[model samples]
Structure formats: structure tokens, C-alpha cells
Target: MLNWDDISREYQSEIENFQMLNTPDERNVRAFLQNCALELHERQTAVTRLYFDQEDKLVGFFSLHNDLVKVSPSLILEHRWNLITEGLTHFPAIKLHYLGVDARYRKQGVGKYLMEEVRSIAKEISNYSGCNFITVEALHSSLTFYRDRGFKLKDSTAEFHNMLFSLETLDNPTLEATPLISKQKIQEIRDKVMSVIEQSNLTYAQVAATSGLDEIVIEQMEFGTDVDVETLASVCQSLGIRFL
Candidate 1:
């Protein structure tokens, strides 16, 4: 359940840590983040959040903001039309300020899921008349995901491989997907792992001793914290998977 309210509430811990840096921590920072999340959601300004669901788990978090294009006077004559065509109601680009998934859920597709949500919301906001480019401070790992989804590089930006996906480009605008791994299902995955060990004739003591994974890690994933990629790889490897 990657809903807004749950996302906001989890930021309290993050805000606390941020406030603690070089100063005594207080509740004010958490309050600010909670308030900002609301503002962003309402204005469609950006969705800043600490990704989490119920049962008090930690997921990744991020912030998005608006950055409408600004044209230089010399370039405006030629570039203005180009900008306008791209949805320059103010300017086409919307900035991606911060984005990251929780360490545990780093590879579970939560980041992509969140990006899809952002893309959908941006498209709805665009209304086809204005707004085209989704400007993000694209991290190296994230570039492939965006590119694979049809976002292209805008020439001027470097490590920030600029990309855009036109709403008109999508074949199925009505697409929707439920979470593939729900709490119940993730629990089942783990249980299956345990069951695998059990069926292999390994004693419970041996299985537990070998797993090394703590209860908190398992519970965190089972409760909606996206499992980390490395952990999943290890888990699958242990289970004799060949997902390549």
C-alpha cells in the first residue's frame, strides 16, 4: 500500500536524523516534512516522501519539484517555439530533486513503481497542451530504467541524461497494476524459502544457523519494505535460481 499518508508519516524518523546533524534534533523538522508532503501532493508541486507502509518500516524516500524552462533572450526567438511545443505553460521541465529506495528494497522495483506514479501524475497535469520534459538529476543506476521505458536524453545535460516520454506515445494510457508482492505474498516467499530448507532435510537448527538473516529484515520485507536487490539475488542464489 504505497499511499500518500503512510509515506508522509514515515518521514518523521528521517527528518529527525537530518535535524540532528550539527544541531540538537527537534520535532520541527518532522513537522516541516509532513507539511511539505501535504503541500506537494495538493499543488502537484512534487511528492516528497519517506516510502513506507504500515507496521512502521523504512523504505526509500525522495522529493520532486517544479523547474519550468527559462529561455535566454537571444535564444528565445528560435527556442521559444520549441519550448512552447513541449508544454511550456510556464516551462516544460519538472525537476526530480531527490529519489532513492530503502536499502532493503533497493532492487524490488519500488523505485520504478514510484516513478510510474510520478509519470502518470505528470501526464495528467500536462493536459497535452503544455509540459513534456521530466527533468531529473538522474543517478547512474536509474538511467537505464528511464531509458528502457522510452525516455530520451536531452542534448544539453550530461550525467543528467535528460529524458521525456510523451503521453501520446503510450499505447495503453489506462494501464494499472497492483503490487506484485504484497505483505502476505512476501511472507509466503520467505516461508517457501524456509520450506525449501525444511524439505531438503536440513534440520531447523541448521537452517536457522545458515540463514544469518535476522527477524527484522524478513519482517521488514514481508511488511512492504521492498526487498533489497542484493539480498534477493543472494536469496535466489541460495535457492538455486537461474533468473538470468
Candidate 2:
């Protein structure tokens, strides 16, 4: 049976050899593995998980990170799930940042297997964290691939589709009872994040440099502007903090 493992030094060689033909996916996989995966993993920016065959060859990989999803009022009304209240505008989620299968394993179920693993991880996180969705920004060509697996488009643009899979669908009673975050709660969390940054003895410029974010955005975040979950995650990673 194929086994899933966290990306580590032991698999570096195999990771270096793994390739996917899809240009964007290929570039991202190679870049992350070659330049950032290890540092990102150590900083808690994102965690890359690998799928290895019986011979221990790395055949595929996916990265997971915390994110926030903004549910449009129309989508909220249409779905009407417990995770989103009429008053709720945004919620935390787990993002599948990148997923790629070796070209040789394309239609042999490796992609599905990785997705199943992602769902399992998301389900486990929901038990302790306030995460409610498993999200992905999929390439245009893979729209049907994700839709067929129960992912619904939360939104879309010319370049990608933002999709979501609600954990509530897993029927975990605890998820049903989880309370929606209030505005006050959001402020409190933001305050805590600022505190972490201050405690780290790092300036906004330093954080921007380390996280690859614009310094002005970090300044705005410090002054209470709303930033996307991905941005917040990058900032947290730079500060050695956990956004979720």
C-alpha cells in the first residue's frame, strides 16, 4: 500500500526528482520544495505532505495552511449551513495550497488519495480549532475534478476557482454546535496577533521581508485593516506564531 508522509530530509532526493507537466503546478511544486518548503514547515507557514509508493518513491504532494474564507451574502443564503450565520461574513478554514501528482500517476487514484488525506486532516483540525472549511484555489482546467469530489465554488476569477468543502458535511455534532465568531471576537484575535508581533521584537518591515508580504500591508494590518487569511498566515509564520 502507498503511504503518506510529511516532507522531510529523508525524502528530499525523491522530491527533487518528482515532476508534474502542468506548468503552473510544476513551477510551484519545484519552487516550494527547492527553496521554501523546509523553512515554511519550520516556521509553520505551510506543511507539505508527501505520498510515497511501496518502493518509497515520492509520487505526489500537497501543502496545507490556515486560511480565512469570505462567504458572500448570496452564498451564505444559498447554503444556509450552521457554519455560516446570516450575520457572519468570514470564517477560518484549512487551505490546500498546492497539490500535484507525478505525471505517471495521474489517473491511477493518487490525486484522489491525496484529497482524502486532506479531508481527514481538515476533519481532525475542526475538532480543536474553529476551522470550518477545506478550501482550494484550483486551476481552471481542474474545475470538474474538484467539483466531482464535492467541492463547490465559493467564488471564481479568470485565473482560478476558489472552492470550499464544509466540514459540517462530515456530520460531526461538535461542528454543528460551534459558535460563530462575533465582531468583538475578531478584534480580540487581531489584538493578540499584534501582541505576538510586538513580542517578537520585529518591525513591520522585518516581517514584510521575512514573509514576502508588502510592508504597507503589514502596517495596515497593525492598524486594524482586514487582510486575507493567507496574508495573516504569512505574517504569523514569519513571527513564529500560529494563526489558527
Candidate 3:
């Protein structure tokens, strides 16, 4: 029941007052808002949402963008790809790029509210666009924060862990249903697509020509903008890859 605000100059003063220090990730959130968030928004690299209290002070915030996840074949169960797309090796997904709650807002359900807001946005996008999973690269110290919200770990190294939440599970029963694509399968397909693109060493100009997308759009996609599913599919097709 908290109000949320899109980042803007009107809220600049309040945003400047936001602070955090628990982890490097937390500190980065503050730095991003103070220095880089507005530029990222203007460049279409990410969208940021901020939550504020009744006093009009910033309480928590998060950022989201498009991303790809590579899943190892060994992680997938049987027949999952068939549900998504036939002969597809990778798929597109939404990324929760950054999430942070001010220390003063922790334990007051602010974090949960921010996550629910993210889910709502993802669900809406899936209804019109094509998003199979909501993915995140969570800091090792914050793994439990995501896990409690139904995110599953796909991979882990020392610094961060790749996690995902299937959009299918978030579907509302009252709404029209869509075919469910398992997270593991989507990850597998993403991995394959990226692998193919890397192996081909396709340049941005070549990809723009092949995909029939504007060079600027293609460049933005490379920089993690949340592009429409159609554009992504076109890019994949041009790359001789299938995406679902």
C-alpha cells in the first residue's frame, strides 16, 4: 500500500538523502541513484522505480532491464524446450538489475513490497511482450534475500549467483493462461543463442543489417535495454538462431 515514484528531477533532493552501507551491493545502489541512474534511464539502459514514505523520503528502489541467462544442458529436465519453442537454444528474459531497501525501511515489509511491484511489472510485460523468466545476478551475501522470494539459483561463483523465477508460476488463475516455459529450459536456450552469437563474431552493423533493426536499437539492446520480444526474435533469426 506504499506509493512508488519513477526517478525524476523532482525527487532529486530526496534521492540524494538515500543511503546504505550493509554490503558493497547496498553501497552501489546509493551511488547508482546519485550518479548514474538518470543517465541510464535517458539512455534506455534500465528503468528505475523508487518507493517513498508518507514524508516523501526515499525508502527503497530497484532497477530492471532485459538480459540473457545461459543454462547448462545438465540442469534441464526432459521435454522442457518443446513447451517453449521447437529447435530453440536460447530465450529472452527480464532482469532485476538492482534492488535495495534503505536501512530505515528494512523489516517493515518494504523489501517485500518492492519485489511484489517487480512481479506485477513482469506479469504485465509477459501479457503483451515475451518474457519467460525474471532473472537476477544476486550478490553472494544477498542470496537468501532472493531465494525467499521463490527465485532459484542457476549458477554460482564466488561473487554472485545467477537466479531465475519462471513467469508461468506467477500467472494469475483469473486471467487467460499461456503455455508454461520452464526456467531451466529458457536458460538453456539463452546459453545456446549467446554461444552462437559469440562464435559467429557478428558485428553490430552486420547484426543491424541482418535483424533489420535500427543500429541505435541494436546498440541499446547490447547495453541491456528492455527491447520488445519481436525485436529480439528478429535479431535471433538474423543470427540463424531461434528464440522463444
Candidate 4:
């Protein structure tokens, strides 16, 4: 069992004692949860959600705030701008500021559960506002996790990449359930490749062997890791696929 509460003074001490001992990133997550999360929460600048285990030990937490998503002129030119936006370029969005799980709870689905909670909250936000996207500045190591959940790269800086998930994707009748592939460029490629592989008898290991690429490479590709064009071509060839 678990309990969810917004960050509050009642849990301040518990929040402070929350441990995230693993990587430099984990330490930073803990630092924010202890030092800054409450301040931001009180100011209403962001909402911080805390989750606890059956034993009442802090398990994980995440923060969120309102944001904006800007449609690039290039994208507007690529699509029917008027049909989709009606002269709008900036749309309301929700930004996930931070998501962290205690190192002790790693691999227990804590992260995924918290992410789904965020998604639910974002969807509710969309219902009342013009918000249509959930955005995040994702760490390099977590890119595959976001991508596997239907997020797409929107932009990037030296330190982090900006990724966004369209809420509209959830309402598509053709896709009754959430599929990792959204109607975006990279996701389209992922959908095609994965769909082909799922339909064929060939295993990922065989594809890697036939392509003469490492199995890890195939695994990375399937999980939305960026691979070079030649490497992608090789894998596609082995899978009897040709990108048109």
C-alpha cells in the first residue's frame, strides 16, 4: 500500500529524511526534495507530490508546474497551420519539474507509478485549460524511459533535452489504448520498426547478429536511443525493412 500527499509541513521532517543515494543525479533529486521543494510548493510556483510506503517511509515524489509549448515556424510550414492552430503558435502545457525515487525502492515500479500519476494530473489539467502537452527537460540517461512512454524530443540544450507528450494522442479513437508511438517523426520510425519485429519470427538477437551490430545497439534502438543512420539502415536491412 502507498499514500499520496502534497508536500506539507506535516511531512517536512519525513521529506528531509528522504534518501536518494545512487548517482550525482539522485543526490541532486534528494537535495531538491529536502531544500527547495517545500519553498516552491508554499509559493504555489509548483506542486510537489510525495508518496510513502506501507511502513510510512518516503518512497518518491515529483513536481509539476504550468508551462508553454511553442510551435516552430518550420513545423507550421510542414503542416496545415490554420487547420491545426488557427494562427496560434504557443499552447498551454504542464511541465514536470522533478521526479525521484528512493534508491532503496529502485526497480520496484516506483518511478513508473509516479509518472502515471503525473500523467493523470496533466490530463485533468488539460480538461479545464487549453493545455495539450506535458513537457519535461529530460536527463540524457532517462531519455529512453520518456521515449518508451510516448514522449518526443522537442528541443535540446547542452545539459538536457526538451521532450513533450501530446495529450491529444490519448484521445485518438484509432489507438484505443495508449501506444508508445505518437504521430511524430521518431515515434513513427519506432512504431514501424517495432511493429515489423513483433510480426516476424526473428528475434532481436538475430537481427543484431545479421546486422553485425551489438545486441545492446538493437536494444537501444528499440528503446528510442539515437543511432546513426548507417547503423539504423543495417538493422532495418536485417529485419527485411526498407524505409521509404
For residues 1-244, what per-residue lDDT tens digits would candidate 2 score against the true structure? 5788777887778877877653564576567776777778778899988888888778888899999988886775676667546578889999998887887676466877888789999999988889988899877445545665667788777567899987887774322222345556556766777898788787887877687555666776787765444455566677777565
RMSD of each: 12.1, 17.9, 16.6, 9.5
- For all candidates, what are the clash counts? 5, 0, 3, 0
Kindly report which residue stretches of model 4 are placed more than 4 angstroms away from their true locations once superposed.
73-83, 173-244
- Over 1-244, each residue of candidate 4 has an lDDT whose tens digit, in order, gives 5689999999978887787644555677788899999999999999999999998889999999999889675754553233266677787889999998886786566777888798889999778887878889886545556765667777877557788777766665222223232236545666677788778866878876576555565676677765444455556677777743
Q: For residues 93-187, could you state the per-residue lDDT of candidate 1 as single tens digits?
A: 55666555544454566767777776776677677546655666444334445555555544334334454544444434433343344555555
lDDT of 3 by residue, 142-168 (tens): 565576676777877656778877677
Candidate 2 RMSD to the real structure: 17.9
Q: Estimated TM-score per prediction?
A: 0.47, 0.65, 0.65, 0.67
The best-first sequence of candidates by lDDT reads 2, 4, 3, 1
**Best to worst by TM-score, what's the order?**
4, 2, 3, 1
> TM-score: which is higher, 1 or 3?
3
TM-score of 2: 0.65
Q: Which residue runs does candidate 2 get wrong by more than 4 Å? A: 172-244
Model 1 compared with the native: what TM-score? Answer: 0.47
Record all residue pairs in model 4 with backbone atoms less than 3 Å apart, i.e. clashing: none
With a 3 Å backbone cut-off (N, CA, C), the pairs that clash in candidate 3 are 89-189, 90-189, 90-190
lDDT of each: 0.50, 0.74, 0.70, 0.73
